[model samples]
Target: MEKARAEAGWLMPKTSGYAACAKLRRRGDYKEGTMDFFDECEIKQSIQRIDELLGSGIFDRKHIGNVLYRSAFIDLLICLRDLMFKCRKFSEPIRFTDDVVVTDEIKHVSDLVKYVRDAVCHPDSDAHYLEPGNIRASLNVLYGKGTLIQTGDFNSVSEHDDDVCFFIGRQRIYLQRHIVRAFNEAKDKLLPLVEAASQKAIAESIAGIIR
Candidate 1:
């Protein structure tokens, strides 16, 4: 139910893009009788949707991944993909403004996000879905090592003592910590960069249409 509520922003344009843009135009929120006005408006609207989807999630997790802590984990990946993915409106490579060095940690986190995103969106099989894999991933991120579960033994996140990850009490804590770290890094360092770039994309798109 909470996830459904959070997805409301992403669903908005699909629900009301045409009518809302028309309404905006009538109100002079966009320049009247302009060539790029509507296109630019749409680009800004897309960026706004991305912003709304980035609303707060659990970042204060004292330990690692939990039932409730998954919001930030999932949302951050979606947000990163939006920023880095190619878009005609923004021709430049998405990057940091202050030039914060992309260290191994950042790169690893990025890779993990993509990996997790793929698993979520396109799993090969039900057995290969987000179960033991998620547990293993959390262990890898937090403990520097992870053990894989035998499918015959454990397959679900709820699967307990039979899981390879079941015995790792230390990892349960680490998993949440890793999640909190990833969420914080994206929020503190990456959010502003993407936001500035998104604004620039909207402005440039508008400029192109008008010129």
Candidate 2:
């Protein structure tokens, strides 16, 4: 500690930490107000975050639930695709050496999401207020590295993450999880191909603008 303080040139005064903390608080020194970009109505009204928009009851909860839950599944694929698209934009198209692509499981989930979207969006609908606690969930998609996933221990799980779906609920509820092991394996294989492609694209773009 002393070495670190000396290295940083933070020569402590003879005064103790308690005295320093009290002095800083008396002057009202640290709490910055929220920035303008954030929506503050929820904070002001003391509305729960999900309740503020998704839970506000402007629309039916079942419809909202179906739409948002489906969106989580849809967005995962979209994010990876968009990231790859952006990476390829300023460079050449990305290529997977093994021709690995979205797994059958992911394709099914994608189709299911589309079906759910149609059901909820239609005026004569098929949406249901899916009892979140009642349904037995299964995993077909995962968002991170594959692990054992049973113990729920931090390190072991990190080392061997199994695919598991999570339903986040409050006023609004949605199902979320990562893609399957196949997806994770493909991502590991393909990221190298696009990583450089993205950098190359970015550099060329900046250079073109300057020229």
Candidate 3:
């Protein structure tokens, strides 16, 4: 602590024992906001796994359930992606120019991600208001009709159980592929934005010191 203060040309203040040590460590390592880049990378990798599973064409209904549950991580990725964009614009002057408008696309994506997250996290119930059909609807919106088919009618349990499961698995794979593609595109765009922003901040700080 003394070394840090001295190097920065500030007076070192004494602190209490364990709490002070913990505080100093936290202060030294603190990030300004919730997003961690590494976690975002992990989410991207998970999205890739979803893609791989889709390509393998070997997953069953239970496997799809696991993927859907794991997709809660996508919400975190979306939050981090938005935060990174905001950080990029942090020092820029606010303006009302039409070109500078923020869109609801991210929010829409987040909402869908949230729906998937909820569906996976909680059991389907009358009170929770989750129907398998809702998941199918969300898949349709995210992936398009060609990739996702919504069937309102299924034959009796013993008659078409295998067919229903097979169809559901196929649709789940399609949904997974679409999600992976979307997240990858978002990541590709946002990473450069974050790097540019960080570089600009560093340049400005250096210029300030030189001045």
Model 1 over residues 153-175: C-alpha lDDT tens digits? 54223223321111221112222
What TM-score should be assigned to candidate 1?
A: 0.34
Name the candidate, 2 or 3, with the larger lDDT value.
Answer: 3
lDDT of 2: 0.33
lDDT of 3 by residue, 1-211 (tens): 3344322222223553244334534666425643233334444455455456446543444454555533433443344334334433332211222211123521343333333444434545221221444533322122123323433452111122222211221122223332444445555555565456445444544555566
The segments of candidate 1 whose C-alpha lies over 4 angstroms from its true place after superposition are 1-17, 20-57, 63-65, 86-89, 94-113, 123-211
TM-score winner: 3
lDDT of 2 by residue, 1-211 (tens): 4333222222224555345434544676324431110112212222233224333432332443455554544444343343333333333333332212134422333333333334434424323223344422222222234432332222112212332332211011112222233233334444454445334434544555566
- Model 2 RMSD vs true structure: 19.0
Q: Estimate TM-scores for all models.
A: 0.34, 0.23, 0.36
Candidate 2: clashing residue pairs, number:
10
Rank order (by lDDT, best first): 1, 3, 2
